[model samples]
Target: MKRSVLKFGGSSVSDFSKIKDLADYLKSRINKNEQLIVVVSAMGKTTDDLLTSVSHLTANPNDKDLAMLLNTGEQQTISFLSLALNDLDVRTKPLTGYQAGIETRGHHLKSKISSIESDFLENLFESNDLLIVAGFQGFNEVGELTTLGRGGSDTTAVALAAALNCTCEIYTDVTGVFSTDPRIYSNAKRWEMISFEEMMEMSALGAGVLETRSVELANNHNIPIYLGKTLSDEKGTWIVPNDQMLERKAVTGVALDKEMAHVTITYPLDSKTFLTDLFYKLEGAEINIDMISQIQNQEGLQLSFTVKESEEKDLNYLFDVLRESYTNLYVKIETTYCKLSVIGAGMRDMTGVASKIFKTLLTSDIPFYQVTTSEISVSYVVDENYGEKAARLLCEAFDL
Candidate 1:
């Protein structure tokens, strides 16, 4: 029998009532000849609450212990969901990431799935009509538990679908992907179909509906992902290959990432090792750097870049260490900035797109800093206060 993989986010299975409702929905979808695998995230706010509690014990908890603690949230979800399904007279089994054989690599709390052992999962499917697997947490090569970073559950679900050679359905609170966040702009249009390339651009640029890595994995394996609201009959969105699209818009969507900080450094040293040593330190810390600009003149070297505001503490610590060597390193961090981006596959064949963007912002007297571009996207950093207004203006200009 063929199998299908479905993933429900934290909000969909947040409580007992929701879990029961989801169980009924799953029962309705069960096919006599097909097996089902359900992957679920921790219930709403459980992971956050766990982190808050851990902070009470120690401000800086070890990554391994944090993973062990945070994983209980998903463990709670799987067991509760299994009980709910069995109570409905459905044959169900619950499994943790380790028990399900999801092997991962990388640092704890941000590990990536290296491989999945499907033999055990296939065996479990023989006597069970459904299997509930915890999402976001997996075991690494050293047999230590690790958690994937934010939106890891989405990655877990898509990875499972790829491994099993099955289609994936992701159920969340929203109906589907929108041209822009509906909360920010009321007229944001919902998309019925989006290409994997476009979706990957959107996610990486802070669309937030699906994690970037998950969409990348799905694209590599040619797995189409269905996204919709849980237990709702409303039409949803399908993420498919680019060739499946009938037409591409000049601009499809807009994304805003408010959690941004701009960092500038003026180093007085002209040593050749300055840039190399600085970047090597950042790489070892796993800090993602974006929008880098470097200039060398009579004033040693002036470097500017953007990074997530969430890494501010780490950036400060790293810079403090660097100061020990480069005593005259002048660093400035501005946290009042947000990154705004427009994405569309149609941009590849289009001209004047960037000009239009600059014109809109300039005419509105909204100042933007650090402009960057990809084949399908153009991003600008603007004051956080102007983020929503800039997004609305761009949406109207592009008719997104």
Candidate 2:
């Protein structure tokens, strides 16, 4: 039988009414000859609510315990969804991440999938027309429950699709991928189709339509993903291989990442050892550095890099450790900054894209703190106040 995987986000299964509506959608998609797997996230803000409740119990709970608590959210969805589908006379079964044969590696709350048993899943489909698998979770070697980080449900869905050799569809709140976030830019154009490469870049740059890891997995495995709104009939966006892209705009989209903080360290010019040690320590701590710059001055060589705001707690402790070794080290952190980026595959051979970006911002008097570029992307770090204007002006300049 031809099989397919469909992933619904938290918003899609937020309540009983939504789950009932989803049951109808699944029945419409199911046929006697084809088997299907449906993956789902925790209903609405259940996961977040669980976390908030945890904070009230204890500021720092054990990671294992946290995973155990959070996994229940998805578990509830599967049980409720399974019941709804059964009420509709659809043969369905609810499976946890482990029961579905997903094995994971890495620590709790941020696990990476190690492997999946395809035969087990194939066997389950023999009798049941549809299997409702919980998303964003898996079991480790020690048999402890672990959750994938934010947007892990998307990753879970894509991984399952790759393993089963089936097409993957993601249903979310948005109708399609826009040239920019519609919430920020109301006039942003919606894309019918986007290249995998472009979509991956945008996802990483904070497009939020799809998780970056999910895009990477889909691109690597030659899987195409369809993203659309739940309970809507509008045609959504398709993320396919580059060769399949229909709109080849030079500037595909403008993306903004607000959860960013810039860290600048002024170290002595002769302190090469200090610079090396800092990076080595960051690597060991699993800190991701983005948009780095270095400049030599009469006093010292100043180093600057951006990291997710969530890392501030780790960085603070690391700085305390470093001060013991280098007493003269000077550091500054700006939490009031946002990273803005422009991405497109067409920019690979295009000239003057960077110049146009700088000119546009310069003319608008939006001063950027740091700038970085890739084959198909250019990023700027600007004050939070200027982020919206920068995106709007750049979108207009590129005619995105």
Candidate 3:
């Protein structure tokens, strides 16, 4: 039997009315004979609210306990959504991550899906018209519940689609993928279709519409993903195979990452040991470093890199550990910075793309701290205050 994986974000099923609307929409779309899997996130800020409630109990909670607490939000959503469907006489079965066969590994608060035993899910499909699964939470080998990190519901949906060998549709608040975040650049253009390679780049570089790991999964499985607004019949963006992307643009879109922090470490000159040790420590800590710029000075070697602001705590601890070695070391942290990037597959053969980005920043008087380039994208770290302006300027410069 053919099946489709449909995922709804938090905002899509925030309230009873929204859940009812979703049930009605599903009723209209599902063929009586076909199988359907629906993955849903916690309604609205329920997850955040849960976290806040936990925070009131303890500032430093155990990772395992935190996961146990956070998983409840998604469970509530799945159960409520399933009840709504059942009310419509749509034979629906709601399952938590573990019951649905989602197996995950790694730390509790942030875990990677190891594999999914789909036999249980297949069995459920035989008896139900719809299988509703909780997103973002799974169980480990030891049977402890774990929740995937932020935007994990997307990962859950895509992984299920891949496992089930079906097409995936992600329903969010946005109508479709756009040239840039419309909230930042009001004139951002919507895309009808985007290549997986381009979409992967955009997602990795801070396009919040889809999770990076989810895109990687979709690309690896050659699964097509459709993203659109809920409660609407409008056509949305399709993330398809590269061969399906016949019309390529020089610049596909602009992405802004506002949650970036800039860190600089200056150590004694002529000390390659310090450089090696610091890098190894960062690697050991599993910190994702981006846009690194190193300068060798007469007095010292200065290293600057960009990382997610959430890692400030880890970075600070590492800095403290290193301070013991380099007594005179200097460290600086800038939290009010963001990365603005332009990505497209056409950039592989395009010229003057970097120049255009630079020209836009210069004309707008937006001073950039650092710049990095890849085959398909150019990213610049700039003041957060200039983030939107820089995106708009680059959007116009590249004609996105």
Candidate 4:
């Protein structure tokens, strides 16, 4: 029997009515005899609400307890969706990560899925049942419960798709990944197909379609990805493996991440020592760094990195730590910084693509304060003042 993994985000399964509607859609497919593995995220705002509760209730919420608390969001979702499916006369079972046989490498909040055993799932599929599993959280070999950090649902869907060797159907509020965040970029359109590498870069640069880690796992496993809207029939984009013959556009899409925050560190003493110390502090704060750069010309190691703006408080805490050891390790914070990325597979061999992108900026010419790149992505930073304008120009230039 053919099987497909469908992942619905919080917005898609936000309410009881939405769950009922999703159940109806699943019944149609379930009746068709397609073995369906439905991965569901916490209902809309549940995770956020959980966070708010933790902050107010406990000064230092234990990780074990916090995991227990945060996981309720998804628990509520999958079980309810399962019941709704059952009401439709479709056989269904709601399984938590531990119950679903997802084994992971004990990383707690950011666990890596080690493997998924299908012995338990075989009977479920044999019975023509719908397996609705909790997204994001998993259990390790020793039975330690772990969650997939931030966009856990996306990661959960991708991981299950790879393990099941099935097509991943990602159902979200948006019809698929867009050329840009439609809310921000008025001209932002959708792509019919995008490569895994390009999608990875997009996710890193704040592409909303799929998480970078999830895209990576899917790519490595040769799982085909489909993005779609939950309430509509509009076809979402397909993220294909790099091994395939990808039909590339001059530019697949342009994306901007407002969450970007910039940190500049200048060392007045030994740079290497200070560099090591600074990274230690960032690690302790659990801040993820991106687009890092270092410059040396007697300016004492000047280093800059981008992180999420939500880390503003965390970065402030980090600065306090740096202020302790290095008296002259001057730091500058820029809250109005954002990253703009142009993605494409054709860009690999295309000369002047970067220049064309930088040149098109002439009309708006948002001064390039910083730059970064990967084989599939070319990114730059701009004052938040001009961030959207830059995104729109790149979108128009790429004809997205």
Between prediction 2 and prediction 4, which has the larger lDDT? 2
Per-residue lDDT of model 3, residues 41-65, tens digit only: 9999998898899878998788889
TM-score of 3: 0.95
Cα error, candidate 2, residue 133 (Å): 1.3
For candidate 2, the TM-score is 0.94
* Candidate lDDT (C-alpha), each: 0.92, 0.90, 0.89, 0.82
Number of clashes found in candidate 1: 0
Residue-level lDDT of model 2, residues 238-292, one tens digit each, is 9999988765778899999998889999887576899888989898666778999
The candidate maximizing lDDT is 1
Over the stretch 128-220, how does candidate 1's per-residue lDDT look in tens digits? 999999999999999999998889999999999999899999999999999999999999999999999999999988898999999999999
lDDT per residue (tens digit) for residues 65-133 in model 4: 777777788889988998888788888889998898888774466667788877677677767578999
> How well does model 1 score by local distance difference test?
0.92
- Tell me how far the alpha carbon of residue 285 in candidate 3 is from the true structure, in angstroms, after superposition: 3.9
What is the TM-score (0 to 1) of candidate 4? 0.92
TM-score of each: 0.97, 0.94, 0.95, 0.92
